[model samples]
Each structure stands twice: as C-alpha cells, then as structure tokens.
Target: MRHITSALLLSGSLLSGSALAECQNTGNFQQWLNSFKHQATASGIPANLVNNALHNIQYDPSVIELDRSQNTVSQTFLQYAANKANSYRLTNGQRKMREDRPLFQRIERQFGVPAPVLTAYWALESDFGNVTGNVQTLRALATLAYDCRRGSFFHNELMHALRLIQRGDIKVPEMMGAWAGELGQLQFIPSSYNKHAVDYDGDGRRDLIHSRADALASAASLLRQYGWQSRQPWLVEVKVPVQMNWALARLGKKLPVAQWAKQGVTDVSGRPLRTSGNAALLLPMGRNGPAFLAYPNFDVMLRWNKSTVYSTSAAYLASRYAGAGQVRYGNAPIQVLSVAQVKQLQSKLRARGLRVTKIDGIIGEETRRAVRLVQQQMRLPADGYPDLTFFQKL
Candidate 1:
C-alpha cells in the first residue's frame, strides 16, 4: 500500500478539458482519496456517497498546474475588459438579452437585478453557455480537495457537490463543470449553486446547465442577496478634468454623483452621468486610460467576481447592453507582470515606507493604494494602475 500525503499532491482543479492528461501519480492519488473517503464518511457524508463519488475519480495535475500558474497581477483591467467584453461577446450578449427579454423581466420583478448585468455575466463566464468546460465536477473536486495547497476550501466545495448530488439537484454521472468544480453554464462553484440556484423554469429542479432560466435566476438571486439595487447603473465611463485633484483618485470613497459632476467629471460624450446616489471613481488603467464612476451596485458585482477586471468588464458590458457606447481610452501599451515581478514591486513599495499589507505579488487594494501614493509623488496621474511606465520609473 502506497501511503500518500496530501502535501505531495498537486493543487489545481480542471477548469478546462486539457487537464485530463495532467493528472500524474495516479497510484498515490487513489491511495489519498481512499483514505479521505473514511474521513468524509466520519464527517457525516454517507459512506455510499463517498464511495460512489470518490472511487472512480482520477487525480488532475492540470488543475494544480493551472492553479499554481495563476498570475493575478498579469492582466491589466483594460486588457481584461477588452478581451471579455469584445465585439463578438457583446453582440452575442445583446442577442441573448433580446431573446430572453420576457424571462429577464420576470426575473427582475422578482429579484431586482437588471437583465443586462446578468447577461453580461453569462457572456463573460461561459460565453453565453457555449463553452462551460468539459471537466467532471466530482473528479475535479475530489482531486482539488485531496491536494494540500487548497485542501480545506476544495474539501468544503467537494462536500457541497456531494450534497447537491445526494439531494438530486443533479445526477452524479452527468455532473460536468469548469476545471475547479464550478457547475452549470454560469460557472458557479458547488456551494454557490446550492445556496443561490432556483428552479425558475418550474421543472422542479435547479438545473443550471440545461436550463437558462435556472442559471440566470440563480445569478440574479445571488446579486439580490448581495444587495443589488434595481435600475441602478453599476458604472459609467467618465472624463476627468486635466487639472483635477489627485487625492480623490483613491477607490472606495463614495461621494454623491452631483459632487462628481461638480468636480468636472463628465460622461464620454461630455455630459454628466445623469444618475443619482453616491459613486466611487475607478481608474481601471492609470489616469491615461479610461475612468468610471462605480455605484454601489458595482460593489455587488464585485462580490460576484472579486477581480477589478471582471467587475469593471461586467459593468462595461452591461452598460453597452443598456444602450451605452464604448468607453473612451487612450492608446497605452500595458506590460504584463509575472508574479515575481509583482512581488518585487511590493517590496519596493514597502521599502519606500508605503503600507502594502501583503507582499503576495497580487495587486490588491493595499498594493493599489501604495501604487497611487507613488504616482502622486511622481505626478503620474495617480490612477493606481501599475503600467509599464510606472514600473520603469519606479
């Protein structure tokens, strides 16, 4: 018997089909899963459920590779927005919105989330249900849960996936999803689906994969649960005055839209955003790139996807779907930073007495704030985006 430790197992769950070939050390992986089955049963998961789900599950090394290869700081917001909300995606999303108008409206009446935003999320996450990945959810979860790097998190997700199966929400054999066990066309992880999925089509099951109604309603329910406000704009592209105050470029400070108008923030067409409520300014790329006034609903979308790129892109796509034009941006070449490079940048910011709470090589809020301070000192727009020039100057 080959005794295997999870520490030796790789991370990464199959988000893509290519991960099938990535699983190595099958003997050790099987041994680990076998041992984990006992633990799963001890934790109250039925022994039959554990055996049925884990017996035939294979280890996926591609999941681990993809997980470890994630460079959170690699893509700039502008790049992400452009790619995710490209012309093809936008056009397809608009068609999806039009075709599903009645359904969307009905969801809105019940959930208070706009159709455009929901459609945008669908388009971004799974390309409007065209490509929901070909990985088995159970296999991915089993491999990820056994992998030591993210064992606890994936273990919980695996248990949730098992419960979803046991509860008959979906069949065990037919459970396919992203590499990381995100089920259905919306790419929801198992726990999210269990919590937010709804049987909107009235077929008696919350089928996020084959049922558009279920997926959209589930997404809307999640937004509504996260406090989505009806008919509120998530974001609006704005033109900042050249001689503006740089201090206000900091994120998370919500001032009234009227105040932003007073500060000379105008829409792309040189008009006020014409919206109510307080908003925060987001310079996705530095000042040289586009700016937007993010509303509270933007925070709701942020909860949907924590990445600034994902949130901003979803908002941008939603705005377009709602008859808004493309955002105006200057042509600036963005440099992709490796994890090591970002870690070095974090260290430099720390050396300069700036507070970068985590030197994790991820450009998080604290890192962005520190970057803004550096830009303010250098008189370089204070947008907080660490572009090529900013990095070179530093």
Candidate 2:
C-alpha cells in the first residue's frame, strides 16, 4: 500500500517557519535547487536530465495559493455539488464521453473501471481537459518539496515528475496540471502517475497527456488498486429517520442494514435497507438534509481525497450518470462555522485531554468521537455536535 499523507509542505505551516528555513525560497532558491538537482543525479537521475529540467524551471505562486485555499473551502454540499455538476460541465462531460467512446471502452475492458467514474473524475479534475492548469511541474513539485513542511515527500514526487520527462512520456513544458502537480485527463499526482499509469494505447509510453486511453485506464487502475468493487455500486441514497440524531450520522457509525431498517433507514425509494455490507451513516448536510448509508466503496474515494464532500460528490455524480435516481435533500442547515474556529475548539479539547485526534479544524470522525467522550465525562448527554455552548465551555 502506498501510505499517502498530506505533502510535507502542510507540516511547515503547522509550527511557523519550523525547519523550512533550510529550503525556503529565499534568494538561494536556484542554488539550493541546483544542489538538490545534483543529489537527484547522484541518486541515478541523469545530469543532462536534471539540467534540462532545471533550466526552464520557474517558481509557481499559484501552487502556494491553491495549497492555502484547500483549507478554506465552504462546507455546504450544495455549494460543492453545484460547482462540480454545473451545466457547462455536464454538457462538456457528455461531449467527451461520446467523442472518446472507443478509448474509454478499451480502458474499462482492461481495468474494470466504469466509464462514468472516469468521466466524473475527468470532468471534475480538469474540466474534461478544457481547463488543465498551466504550471511548471518541476517548480511546483520542487518548491513544495523544499518548503520544509513536506519537503521530503514533495522532493520524491519532484523526482518522479522529472523521471516522467526523462522517460519521454510527457514533454517537460506540457506536464502542466493542478497546482499540486496532478497531471493530465484525470488529476493524478506525479507519484500516482509513476505508480498507476499504463500504456493502454500501446504506443510504448504511459502517455496520460494526449491519450484518453492511458488516462482513463490509469484512473481505473488507481481505483481498482484502492479496492473498488466493480460489481458494487458506489453509495446508495437512503431514507433517514425523522428526529434522528445528526451528530450520530457524521460519526461513520456502521450498523447492519437490518438494524438500519429497524430504525427507519431505507432505500431512496423508501424500500427496506439492502443488507449486503455494513453501511456507514453519512450526513454531509445538517439534520434536515439528505442522508446516505455509504458502503465500503465510499471509503475508497476518501482514500483518494480525504474530504468527505469530495468523495460524496464523486459517488453521487458517478451514480447519477450511471442511471441512479436523483435524491431529495431535506431542510437541515448544517451549522456554519469558520475553519479557524473549528481548530480553536479542537485545540481546547486537546488541552483538556479530550483526544481531538488530528489538529486540523474539521470535525471528522476523530473529533466527534472526542466530543462524545468529553460529553460523557462531563455527565452530559453524548451528542457529538460541536456548538457554541461547547466552545464557550472550552
């Protein structure tokens, strides 16, 4: 298993300057990059390859901007859904699916990755290749690697990116992508490209850049590697009980389908819960919004992206395009709190020894479990919602 974590850059922003001073983009950026490049060459990378890559390298400010922006995105599922499933996007998605039928079909046959999943990822990541970002891969990866927080990881990623250029799979200038260095039709990071990409077109290259065959196949390979069950659906929209505890829904609490049926959870059409696998109760919106009983495949998407809303969107969109029925969200407004405040409350809870697992401000499984534990310890009812009352007490 490729034990993935956030790029080391995030660790730098954690403690302020930390160890980044060593690789910070001071005036010595070029010098350090040259030395870094030499070490890369000494480690079996070609010197000409390093010179060819470093010669055109320029610092990318946008990567830093996007790196910062990831933490501040809104929590509303609709906001995310509207952005992901917009009209222009849907139109373009259909067009791409039709135009690239043979390539997509070939990829699906080989990788067992459904076309809709590939289509969804394609449309979402780079807008079906229309809006692939134009950032230098070397600089983006190198700058991130040297950023002290996640330098080691990014440095390794930078090496893989340079290797792509060396292997002649993609031109250095054409290796553009998201600010984080994810490339081609599906937004795969450099490390992912090295690990999962395939030469589906048989052109003697794992050409994700200009070939839909390779890109879609590569995406499918990634999902399969991540344990996608081709025979299974991604997630099923479910009927949640009225007066159900919203806090409990977000905890990734798993119960048998029969147990859920006994408690009023049902299929989207109000049928009995299908007892095939243990389902996790998920509520992206608040108490009044739509709820889903997500299955194992849902966790697969989380492995790709840690965000709940992102994986939810991928599952929902994939199912939607795959002929799944639309779902109706009810009237619950998930509590709106800024990112910073969430962190503040979490830090306070940590100080009180409540075990708010990760320090990130988001109230994920760990934080909610910590909340429930604190509530029980305080001789209070253990609802896992973080409220102003909890903040004030902290």
Query: Against the hidden reference, what TM-scores do the models get?
Result: 0.85, 0.83
- Candidate 2: where are CA atoms >4 Å away? 1-27, 56-72, 98-102, 243-252, 331-335, 338-344, 357-361, 374-394
List lDDT for all candidates, in order: 0.76, 0.69
For model 2, the run of ten residues with the poorest summed lDDT: 1-10
Which residue window of length 10 is worst by lDDT in model 1? 1-10
Error of 1 at 260 (Å): 1.1
Q: How far is candidate 1 from the true structure (C-alpha RMSD, Å)?
A: 6.3
- Angstrom error at residue 271, model 1: 2.5
Residue 72 deviation, candidate 2, in Å? 4.8
Off by over 4 Å in 1: 1-28, 42-44, 330-344, 353-364, 377-381, 387-393
lDDT per residue for candidate 1 within 1-394, as digits (tens), equals: 1011111111223222122233333347777777878877887878997797766688887877665554343456666677777889888888888888999999999999988888987887778887777888788888788776667778888888888877778988779877777777787888878888899999988889899999999989888988898877888888877656656865688999888888888877787667879989887766667888888999887777665665677789899898888778743544657667887898899999998766666666778899888988998877677866788889
At residue 127, give the lDDT of candidate 2: 68
Candidate 1, 232: how far from true, in Å?
A: 1.4
